[model samples]
Target: MNFDLFWLFRSLPAVILGLTIHELAHAYTAFKLGDMTAKNEGRLTLNPLKHIDPLGFILIVIAGFGWAKPVSFNPEHLKNKHRDEILISLAGPISNFALAFFLLLCARGLFVLPYFHYTATGIEIINLLVSWAVINFGLFFFNLIPIPPLDGSHIYTTFLQKTNPRLFQLVYTYGTWGLLLIILIQVNTKIQILPIMPLIKAITNYCITLLHFT
Candidate 1:
């Protein structure tokens, strides 16, 4: 497949911003939950480099779904360890969804403004906003798959711990391979196993439809 450098360039800013905010949300949530591990490790910042995993970021650029450096937190420091861990793990995706909504609103508002004609600048701004919204939404949903190393796995494991320790152990031990297998299928096939892009489009289209601007 041929790579589109211009498309990559246009999407880079949004990807970086989405990843940064996603990770910062994790770090901040962990800190607020009394686990200062991420904060102490200097992860409580908006710096893109601090959050960007090289391989993951490259995958995002090429494949549309990727991850970032996970924020580490000590469970001992949390009051309700399992529940709190779930909440902390959820913060990243929640932040991305929030950003997606905000960017959607911006795109809609820009389209509705009387002074905002479809000039080069206006078109660029709209494209940027839409790109950012799509990226954020992609991140939000992509991270919600219940697989190891992703935020959703923490929640799944937490709940499983109370219900079935054996099953939890089984999943915990083998989950990484499941995630790797999904990536492998995505990379090797055209079937598009993950529906992240369709979900992003649906949400974005809904937001734009709500605005009734186009």
Candidate 2:
């Protein structure tokens, strides 16, 4: 199995930043909603080490997508358990979208610098900015996949729990395993059951167009 270590190296900053902010958003949102579990557990900090999972980080380096340690929160402390949980889960992905937009805006501003194209450092900065923006965009979309343990699952459950109990239970029961199986299949077969890559590509392309990045 050959992997491009240099590509991974370049992507490291984006991965760390994206994952760190994602978890922090969850922790912060939970705290805002009266759940101090994540805050008390020392997960409210912006430190990447506190949020990153070793296996997840390694997978990101080798594969282009992975998750971070989920911020733990107690629903009992929340004002409205179901609604708050959905809010907390939604925070992570929304934070990624915000980060992506900010990064792309910065990249756009940087690209307009008079000597940006001529200087090696400026070019590198632009590349990193674009890379970071795209990575965050991908993360934002990936987390929205409605599978168990993913933020989307909470969203689906929140809206459907009252309307469709049986379906929610079925997905909750087998979602994680199904997600893993799909990941494995995608890695080995290069066929996507979920089309995550295409979605990511579309997002990146949109960002590029929006930023007018040459």
Candidate 3:
């Protein structure tokens, strides 16, 4: 593990922002759908400390995988249960993609200057925006995996009505077992079945292209 202080310091801000906003979107959308649990807990804000999942954040820096403290929601509070659940569950990953798109636009539009002055620091700005874009892209793709306790699992439950819910129920019940199994498999397999690295690279390349990189 290359534990360089400088790299960690630079990566810190974007990781914090990425995790915070992704969770905030979950809270906000759920609240709008009539769940006030997250709001009552004061999780609707952008404070990274509130959303930081310590182990998850650490893994994010070390292995590029991270998650935040999940925002609570009372599904019973929603008027339209099915539609509302789908929307709320979809909000988290969707928000990360939105963030990626916004970062890509800013990187391409405002930072790259073939016009009005400031050519010297363009590389710095490009790096920052590219970093921001990659972080969000990773979050977006990773969270969309349909595994137990992930946002994508919630999404799948909402959408895939025909699947054996009991199977996922078992996964949720034995969540610690499931997590341990996942980690062990990841270590031994040496090939991630659902690796998001390719998707992350694709998003980065798209960003570079948007910024007119040849």
- Model 1 lDDT, full chain set: 0.85
What's the CA error at residue 36 for candidate 1, in Å?
Answer: 0.9
| lDDT values for all models | 0.85, 0.86, 0.76
Q: 78-138, model 1: which lDDT tens digit per residue?
A: 9998889999999999999999989978888797777674688887888789888888888
Every model's TM-score: 0.90, 0.90, 0.82
Please identify model 2 stretches exceeding 4 Å from their true place: 159-170
- Quote model 1's TM-score: 0.90
Worst 10 residues of 3 by lDDT: 111-120
Poorest 10 consecutive residues by lDDT, candidate 1: 111-120
Ranking by lDDT: 2, 1, 3
| Model 3 C-alpha lDDT versus the unseen true structure | 0.76
